[model samples]
Target: MADDFADVYARLRTIMLEAAPAMTINRDEAGALELRMPGIDPKTKQPGWFGTVTTKKSYVAFHLMPLYTAPDLADDISPALAKRKQGKTCFNFKNVDNVLFEELSALARRCAAT
Candidate 1:
């Protein structure tokens, strides 16, 4: 495993945890952390996904589920951080970029609150 992936995952995981400290932790293991909204979700009848940090082969992925339902939460994202976005709500990083990570942290907080 690349040290970059480990470091990136660690920081991203911290951002997720700090952003949604009250969210249910669906999984927390060596390379993945999943945070979910407490209580059963109306749509899935399972805990709603708040976010996740996973170590991928080439990068660590931070997924914020709220961004899918509330796109406006990302309106203030910096271009540098926006470039890391992989899809509707996933950000991929190979290394820790403090500037972008801080931006992501803010975004994650909004996502958690939303």
Candidate 2:
């Protein structure tokens, strides 16, 4: 991971934990950090959310999967996600901004609550 990506991930992890203490943050088999709330299922659940922060060759990417496949989410995040060149539900943040981080944290909290 790039240094900036690591920094952003650390900041995001802190923000997320602060907002939703019940959620768990861990590394997946690919070494990407997976943020998940216990008891939430991506399938058979109304709101199943998960996210990963990754560092690719050119940029740092944040991929968020919103629960329930809501078009509202795509509509809401389309501007920020305009840079994506691959994947179904991915958002690329060239630089992590307060607004984006806060929105992500809010989403995490909302998903955890459901």
Candidate 3:
């Protein structure tokens, strides 16, 4: 692991946690921290998936489920931010400096607000 990888993970995880205070959090079997929020399942009327955040080998990933559920808002990602995106919901960060921290924090807040 890189010397600053844990720092990056901590900062990104904190951003996600602050974005959704009502989210339910737990430690995964893989030893990653997980945060989730429940929603109605529409057809079944049961709890549904909302969002999540987890750490991976080289980068920390922020999984914004709302983008999968909504699809449109994701199109607005700026060129600079798009460089970090791994998929529709997965944004990977290898280095977490002040700029990346602020960007991820803002993104988390926006996703949480949806």
Candidate 4:
């Protein structure tokens, strides 16, 4: 793990928490962090996994599960951020700056809203 990774994780984690206060936080023993909105079992009323964040050795991955349910929101992501996407819903970043943070902040709000 890089020395600066903690800062990167903190910034991304803050955005998730600030944008989605209702989500449940699950701290992985390995040190990764996740903010999830449970999916009600409907019949059982049990909470299921919704979305999350997992910090890897090289980059911090933001998993917006809502994207799978509502793909339209992907349109809001900038071309800049789109380039950083590794998969359908994961956006990975090794370093962050003001521009990325602003774009991500908007994305977080939109993700939480959706």
lDDT of 1 by residue, 1-114 (tens): 467688888888899999998899989998999988986889889988888999888888899999998989999898888899988999999988998998899898888776
Q: How would you encode candidate 3's per-residue C-alpha lDDT over 1-114 as one tens digit per residue?
A: 356577776777778778877767645433156666666667878554555656677677777777787767667667877888877877887776677567767777777777
Worst 10 residues of 2 by lDDT: 77-86
Measured against the true structure, the TM-scores of the candidates, in listed sequence, are: 0.95, 0.59, 0.78, 0.83
- Candidate 1: regions farther than 4 A off: none
What is candidate 2's lDDT per residue for 30-112, written digit by digit as tens? 31556665665757773234666666666655655554454354445535544442466555555667877777666656645
lDDT (CA) per prediction: 0.89, 0.57, 0.69, 0.74
Q: For model 4, what is the error of residue 50's alpha carbon versus the real structure, in angstroms, after optimal superposition?
A: 3.7
**Which candidate wins on TM-score?**
1
Worst 10 residues of 4 by lDDT: 27-36
Candidate closest to the true structure, highest lDDT: 1
lDDT by residue for model 4 (1-114), tens:
467677777778777778787778766433376765655747667564455666788888877777776778888778888998777778888887669778877877888876
How many residue pairs clash in all the candidates, one count each? 0, 1, 0, 0
**Residue 21, candidate 4: C-alpha displacement in angstroms:** 0.3
Model 1 quality (TM-score): 0.95
RMSD of 2: 4.4
